[model samples]
Target chain A: MGDIEITELRKLTEFIKQEFDYDFKNYAMSSFRRRIQRVLDLYKMDSVDELIRLLAKQEFFFEEFISEVTVNVTEMFRDPTFWRVLREHIIPNILLNHNKISIWHAGCSSGEEIISMMIMLDEMGVADKAKIVATDVDKAIIERAKKATYPLKNMEVNRKNYLRYQGKYTLERYYKESGSEAIINPSLLENVSYRKHDLVQGSVFSKFDLVLCRNVMIYFNQTLQNDVLHKLHESLFKYGYLVIGSKESLIWCDIAHKFIVVNNEEKIYKKIKD
Target chain B: MPKFELSTKYKAIVIGGSAGSFQPITQILAALPKEFPVPLFLCLHRLKHVRHGFVEALSIKSNKDVIEPADKESIRKDKVYLAPANYHMALELGHFISLSTEELINNSRPSIDITFESAAYAYRDKVIGILLSGANKDGAAGMEAIHAKNGMTIVQDPSKSVINAMPNAALARTKVDYILSVEEIIEFLLELDKKYRI
Candidate 1:
């Protein structure tokens, strides 16, 4: 086909799944097209067929392609209001119910979600009683997340968000500046376990008391969104909480009846069914 | 019952505005028929951190329901879908809403360019794009994108806008199909609605 990118999207995705063993067939067509366009522009390829030919020839390029495919533009305390609610109400309830809380940062990009959680828990003096799992499909991103270092330009928004969350100390107190980079405190990740699990194909590794899969589902089509919701539902214990993106919801998903809304605006839900 | 004799019907009407277009937008929504045939997608600049009141305010004057669509939400005709704050909303291939937090384009999260370009991409010539008043040049390239795809482009009259930068920017680069004042724009939209086939 002449314009395979738009017309034969399914063919490209199927080829990728069969060749690379990653399931991108279920990704939302718009965002997938955008990301694929980025990859094409970067490599100066003519079309999806040309890109596929190169991918088949160079096995070493998949890792690099994975980085470009996944969007990693996340921030610490991206939504301060959501963080405040989680810190003030949700975590306290979980703490009251159990001595320890297990949190799964599903689709955690570059460790900001994990770091933000640690800071929130630290502020509440409950850091010791928490276990966190951070996962992404890309191992390279996971490695960068583990390092917890971010460039200074990214910090402007991060710092602004943290202040809005009403932290006890300045965000700068947590990271030291070094040549245009801010190195986050590694101690924040002491209880966090990072994994390179694909949300699309990887099995549910374990259940959690709380699962945060914010903004990740935006890239998936409705069919895959429903499938992932069921998977996430199974990965939560009864009465456990699920927090999604501000715009995405558990309300409109297949498992809507299984969960009760805890905070609608923040998109936090409590799983009531097993 | 096709209203117009066009070979292909327009699928969507995407309007982008920044600062001063809200009044015109309010008038447009308040004046459209309850069951307008074409879908209306609006991308307006609003506060990123504050998301509670904008939709409510828009809904107050709107004859039809004004919604801040969720990610992956279905696109239906007549309903006014506003790009929710802090997310870039795109019109997908199958008339679905695609929301993303990709890096800000033109210093806006709900960037007008993204939504307008998406409309042009999905609908091609079956799209109508409108650019309204603002201080920034965000929607200029979007109107250009629509023009490139053979989709119709409309710009608010620069002299009638609250601020002229946005519409004037579009006028400067592209040959827009219409440059109408607020009253004429409302009249034109009503005419389009009448001519649209459900």
Candidate 2:
């Protein structure tokens, strides 16, 4: 985009904040610009100004805009090694320290990772003792995640990842597949709650034994990332575990000294002190 | 070839290429002075799963520091930042690089378009975008984005590229500022260093 377009986008972001009370000023500008451009193209609007006018006039347009901007790209048991480490090392250690576990999957888009964690807990005989909360900025995706029915076509990849995770039971055991959809057994999500929580703007709702915020911080700029990391740090109980995306690092943040590396390769860290 | 003065306004250099791009990229990096003023981002497509040893190979050939950036790492001058495989790398506000596993654009992770477009958006006219030898059209729209932002755009001369499809595709999309051979490109970098370095 040109300078004029960028300036107009800045104005649109400010307008959204003032009118809709949704603040996007801290988002990484490149991805924000790309998503805004996509919204403009999708609506066949000439510019950000046009989109701003439409958003002000129509309520439904805001929903579409929010859905478009919040990316819900994820899969079950992604990076099997990380899950293996979680199962063999992290979960077992957490169990030793606490009688009951509280887990939070921040930016839990589509509920894949939360389901994976629940299944793992079930296998470990700790499912009844664990309470999980999964959240995202978009309510629409959280609703889809609540349904827990995924297309059958995605099962192959999910199954492959599960197998690589060395899952004792076949993935099919957790879900009943019929026609084009596979609905996860409702019992798995019994202790889990899905909610809409903006990581950037939302306050810490509770403390947790573990916080898995993988791949979400990549969409934020460094200052926002530092702020979110501080919040995640504040949200974790003493000695709580934090797992981020495989490619993401915490070394650059001011909170680096507050956490000790539990597994550098997997990007897992432990809160060192209160 | 006629010589042109390098613009002092440029703050960052982004070079993107794919299949058969390594040789020319190495040549250009080797030609650049160790004290080259602007930071450089290298987005070359490579095998996704095999992650080790790429930066070392490039480091052996280039005079400046070459490293695969950790996600959210701050961008620095006199260093070559290689896009890690299996992630779409982008610049954030011209200060740091962010990596994403979002669905691939143009069927490649570490997509050239993402890096180029992000750099263009972040740096505006203070960016230089170079599309080098490659087998696909991933960088075409990115070059256009840079042109639209008034950033300098260069494409390798198609005849000099081992894989001409990339440069030809970029040529088709926008009026590139320069279409130089690999040797000329290296010379141009050297000229840029001479003109801009303090």
Top model number, TM-score: 1
CA lDDT of every candidate: 0.88, 0.87
For B65-84, candidate 1 gives per-residue lDDT tens digits of 88999888889986899999
Model 2, TM vs. native: 0.89
Q: Model 1: per-residue lDDT, tens digit, A170-213? A: 99989999999999988878999999999989898999999999
Docking class of 2: medium
Each candidate: how many clashes? 0, 0
lDDT (10s digit) by residue, model 2, range B78-162: 7899998778889878598888877778989889999998888788888899999999999998999899988999999999889
A42-142: candidate 2 lDDT, tens digit per residue: 87877788888899999777877988886677789988888999999999999997899999999998889988999998998889989899999888889
Interface RMSD of each: 0.9, 1.6
